[model samples]
Target: MKKVSFLLSASALSAIAVPALAQDVVFKPVVEARLRYETVDQAGPAPLTSSRDANAVTMRLRAGGEISKGPFAFLAEGEGTLAIDEDYNSGVNGKTLYPIVADPENVELNRLQLQYRTKPLIVTVGRQRINLDDQRFVGSVAWRQNEQTFDAVRVEYMGVKNLKVDVTYAISARTIWGIDGGKFGSANRPTQIDGDDVFANVSYKTKLGTLTGFAYLVDEDEAVVALRRNSSQTYGARFVGALPFTKKVKLSYLASYARQSDYATNPVHYSADYVAAELGLDVAAFKLTGGYELLGSDAGATGIAGGFAFQTPFATLHKFNGWADKFLATPGTGIQDYYAGIGYTVPKIGKAGPLVASFTFHHFSSDRLSIHYGDEYNAQVTMKLNKHLSALIKYADYERKGIASFTGDADTKKFWAQIDYAL
Candidate 1:
């Protein structure tokens, strides 16, 4: 019977090729790398250094991948770095070293992106990382080992379930390490052309928490409005809950007011006002935070000045406050900031992992409408020897009182130890 009709058509083509190879469409790839070491010590006045020392080493790499079929999906990533030994115009007795580690085997290109999701819509476009709200002034600086990436196009919406919405627009920005790394210079480079930033947020959630409202706009191009006219327009509101006398201890509050006119093209057309507040505590693994900020002055504005403010895209932004960064440009007698911090997470020494710590203190003054004021201290420690290795250490110190000659009472110290691995 013709060999049983060719074995029943080869068993119906092997059951339709085993469900089309189980509905094939799978892709996965990823990579990561890191190495770091640092040291610095400096001291005040004559002979340029109550003391001095420096040593550095750094390396990084990353790779990406992802793809799916059912609801459709895709993703991408990239990274690079190198900064071994370090020697960019070395100085010991002449004092000419402030992160000018020129040729530590330089390499760039931090991130590349592409994403899509459906179910309330989610979209992302090339060169990513942007953080709004509570970032305190824009973000994505990523603590530098080469970060800060944006070439944007982002959109997000959550149908309804406590209401959520997000929007982002940016054409270019790729600044990470090198603008004179560390203390950033080249006039604080970060204004890649075709600039645009617009953020709109609306949120509502209850059970005694979550409320947000925001509007922020940034438009620049003319060399970033001739070096930070900061292209103004801002409005804000934020509130977080769970402290009706303690629901495990949690509280948050923020208020913002901005009115900067003359379009700020930098020929000194002044108008300014800003205010801030924050408080938080968690109590289980222990955490505490505090904040107070104010900037207001414009009576004969010659070029509007302010204080303790200049996040300018963040990522471990020097833990915020003055050392010799010369107040990061903002002084028209406008500035004041008081800060506090504490954090701890231990609970896991038996498995050889778990230990974290933090400490911060800052007090800067100046708003007799903006010159400069100073006091700062910061510390951090981290340890986790499992799930891909980890270790870190950090420190910073600064002090200067009474407009201390452009604020450089010149007492600084920095040190870091690092180890990280993941795949």
Candidate 2:
């Protein structure tokens, strides 16, 4: 991994651009920094690497600015990460001996774009970051120091009351793992999606709640068979809302469903289904939720020539399934996750303002067949020291069960501590 000293340089570049383009444009500069320490411990017999523990401490810095001149504007940002200690295996580094730490060391362009805006419609071109809804399908993977950005063109329309429509066409996906074939790399090769990709989303906000409909047509680079399977088309609808039954209590619910099928040059002729539902209630400063999710299987596809499951290859997987990332890839037999969690926001203590804490549990099973996959528990605590600084502590543990008979996943545990400063 290469050490990057561009944080100062990026600031200099932003300073130069904002003034040079100040002819008539309104410009706002953006800068943020984060320092994190992460550790992982995993144990499994078959696929176990030589080292079961990993430790990494890293820092990320970003600088950029947004400029607007009338209805036309421009934005550019740069990102860099410096790793002080790298005792873990970064998949790309062939550090196969230790547990994996996906965060790599590198410097690169994060976002740059031009925009045209009107009262009813807006258009953007170049490389940018895009997030939809809760980021279940498409997201920037912001949890990682580095971000996921896309080279594309996007259009948004908000002419109608309570409704907005967004459409985008992307040529490539710049992953957080940085560029492919670099030191401290990730397991995902190419580190990008280089092909025709389209995303369409329509959302309506109502007095009752929010309703959304979406279609995602994703095509992968055909040059590699491994990447070809990622090509697929999905259509879905989601509903989320809250109801204030009483002044002291509020109830919320989320329900979603989507259908997926092979697309483009994918050899697979399989179709699968996805379903997610959750219900929650807020009492006082505490909230509790219960949910169930299913990733249906293509157990009988002849063209694909193998067991296939409904997959969200582009989703921010860490936010769902589990934090241990054991289910990053849905198993061929599919999966069912029954989960529940609780969250609390407490009064300030000392220098830290308020404190937020949450805990969640998940039970996993095979969706198609009857089999116990595993169980997991996760806990997190966050505190804001001030306006610009925040602290976090999180942990995850997964215990394996019988489903390993079909899925080659492992049991793992992880811990993370971090502090972020924004300016």
Candidate 3:
């Protein structure tokens, strides 16, 4: 309560100061809302619940504004979420009888930060959002009802043309769960995680592509017992670019590699590697893509028995692996994924707007144990109703395969419908 009061007071003072300074200032207000319905069904033999189906209807709202003057700005935002159908385990809701649906009901401050921006340099401080290239290592986790944020300081230097440097030092990570999710250091999913985390990135652009080098050192402060095992250091590089074959055709590609090892006070002493490559071809309004990703394992290492695969606990897990979310946590034997997809953008229809439809398939396997986990099929369609409104329909099906004892996930299916509005 006191912190919220302080943020309000600060904003009021800033609004008054801007007029007194007699400078050119701009204030932009923001409002957004989303309503969604999701359902899930899985075959027998799941761990958390005896029930095989779940239904969840959720709504979220965000309200805030930005106050800015030349090279200086202050932003404050608040977010809230409501659940109409709670027939599912929200991780923090204690509804263990139904399948897991992560979005919970709660409210809290979202973002409050101050920034200084100029031609070749930008600095930001306070609770903010930091999403690096592709968001593979560090991201905002925006797909969830409550997005993740960081209480930290960030700096960017771009004095050299086609070259950029970015760095950040964060003290705490505000998780996707809301106020009802419990405090930091909780055994379950905590609302906050205290840590000494750092991220650094340097990128240069060329005719062929853009090349980037980065290092992420995450330290889940020992006080957070549930997350201590996630502490690690990762160093990686990435290349992404596109080539124009003609006026109507283009080729796009991305390749990334990262190495990870235990860091800070983490009890685990092991190392793993990550590799990913994706290619896409676009001709006119149609697109096709294929990719492979490997979350390497440390099995049979010096002192480790089962082994741990490369983990990206803070990443937007939903965007990778598969939409079925079966691989949110990498298996002990590690995992490999080969996927392909096709998409099309339809021309505007009447006053409705453009429509986009896509379908993807994924084949999953173990990196070391030679186990075929399963295969997943995903389909999605999105339509823009107007400028401020849109709708989405999506579905996913994952069929369990291989030895049932070795693979834990059951045959699962999920469906979703959503409506969004922004202003």
Candidate 4:
């Protein structure tokens, strides 16, 4: 009887042990490295020798890993950049002789997060990358070596078919410019409150398109007094969809509108509006697009110069305006941008998977005063060397025009060459 009892006990132990071992956690590694050379040449300053053209070569490296079991996972990442040529002013380092090169040398934590996901819900906590609505309002700023991240908790619910809801409450916005009061030494560099912000979005899909409504509320609390006064509330809606004109050709459109007003501790009491429209056509590997965007101004027009104008301080401003980045901040008179572009892709070229090229042109003007901001042209070529490797070359040129009511438009030229490896 004793032997039989022992045999049963052994069988039960094996059954439990096997299931426990199957639940072990597994880790996946994430690695990326890039080498880039950037050059900027500009003309038309009041003092010809105020700043010289800049040239710099830089490298970025990042590594991280994710561990997961069932519905729970954890991630940690580290990032660093090294400059081969320090001739350019990195917005830090005090090299004022050269034009600005925003890519500074630094090492810091990139992402660290805990996540839980189920069939209908997903939640993430800690510092992470967030991109919303084409990244117009917020994005990781991946072009820079030190990408931006957010220290916040995000939640998404998708239980209702065709409808989804997402929300984020962030205490801090980690910027690509790196941490403040540190090496770079700026209060808002590593963090931005956007006056204690909250973002909420809801979306529903239909045969016509996907429609989304959003609200972004910001309190006034920035390191810069002028910036702090920029605190406001924005409510908007967006629609994006594709129309199948034929089996081989398709048309796409995006339309958005928003209204902004002072909120929280902001002293500004003016109201402004925002509008955007775009249309595109796609056939095979070729694409063509045209777009127009406007940011309404308040007579009180652009605050930069003291006018009340619509502003998106927390937006991924680089993606819009133009490649020269002359309009990083909207002028006090408000702004309007008209643009067009074309792109093509060739597949299976020799050992490389594909090659892609694109060119775009933009015209800038003030919405309030009808002042011509300038004109810019941009072009890029990209090649996929392998599944995890790619190369790119990009160029941009901006023609002089009257901007900010200044003496004249500053003609600017820029070029970039980059190689990336990812896994």
* Number of the top-ranking candidate, with lDDT as the measure: 3
lDDT of 2: 0.82
Taking all chains together, each candidate's TM-score versus the true structure is: 0.31, 0.91, 0.93, 0.89
Off by over 4 Å in 4: 1-23, 47-50, 180-195, 301-306, 403-409
lDDT of 2 by residue, 340-403 (tens): 9999988688866789999999999987768788999999999999889999999999998853
Better of 3 and 4 by TM-score: 3
Between candidates 2 and 4, the one scoring higher on TM-score is: 2
lDDT (C-alpha, whole model) for all candidates: 0.57, 0.82, 0.84, 0.78
Q: Candidate 3 — which residues are off by over 4 angstroms? A: 1-20, 46-49, 182-186, 222-224, 301-304, 404-408
Selected candidate, larger TM-score, 1 vs 4 = 4
Give the per-residue lDDT of model 3 (tens digit) for 1-423: 344345345545654565456567788897999999999887746462246488999999999998888877888889999999888777788776677788988798888887779999998877788899888888998878898998888999999999999999887888887786663233558888777899999999999999999999999884554488788999999999999999989999999999999989677787899999999999999999999999998985445467777888778889888898988878878889999999999879899979999999999998896889999999999999999999999999988885452434878889999999999
lDDT by residue for model 4 (196-257), tens: 67888899999989999999887646656666666889999999999998886999999999
Candidate 1 wrong stretches, greater than 4 Å: 1-50, 74-120, 123-129, 132-136, 146-155, 158-366, 369-423
Superposed model 2: Cα runs more than 4 Å off: 1-24, 181-187, 303-306, 403-408
After aligning candidate 3 to the native by TM-score, how far in Å is the CA of 320 from where it should be? 0.3
Report the error of model 4 at residue 152, Å: 0.2
Per-model clash counts, in order, read 11, 1, 0, 12
| Better by TM-score, candidate 2 or 1 | 2
Candidate 3 lDDT at 83 equals 95
Model 4 has an lDDT value of 0.78
